[model samples]
Target: MRTNSFTLLRQMVESGMGIGIVFGRFLQVRRESIAFVELRDLPFASPPVACCRMAGRTPTVSSEAFAAAIKTIFHNYGG
Candidate 1:
């Protein structure tokens, strides 16, 4: 089973349906019903993300800033 919802994933894990593999950040503030195990040594790559806009459209200043912020975050991640 696959879902985009973290809440549903947590609920399934808490209900003992199965285990979930998510980023450790999501486990920072969590309920006690489930025990989280961080797989730091696992060789998994994060999926690519994009900041997309319609073709030939001019980006707003806020959008440009947001893209820059995202780029900075990606560069600094896991460092």
Candidate 2:
């Protein structure tokens, strides 16, 4: 099944339907019926979350300041 299908299954489980399997590191916060089963190990990978601006508009000074503050917090936290 596709990742979209898995997401739909998770939604159904959240909505009280009794079909489908849901699993992930963050799913622990979900209900108890949503079991956390291990699947076969695969190479670990994820996409980066990048920030970009439109050609006509620049990010505001406040936005830049907020980003810098977040970076400073992460650096202090050893992220």
lDDT of 2 at 41: 23
In candidate 1, how many clashes are counted?
Answer: 0
Cand. 2 Cα-lDDT: 0.44
After superposition, which runs of candidate 1 have C-alpha atoms over 4 Å from their true positions?
27-30, 44-79
Among the numbered candidates, top lDDT falls to 1
State the lDDT of candidate 2 residue by residue for 1-79, as single tens digits: 3444756656665564433423334334544444433323223332232222222344578757865675575466553
TM-score of each: 0.46, 0.32
Give, for candidate 1, the lowest lDDT window spanning 10 residues: 47-56
Residue-pair clashes per candidate, as listed?
A: 0, 0
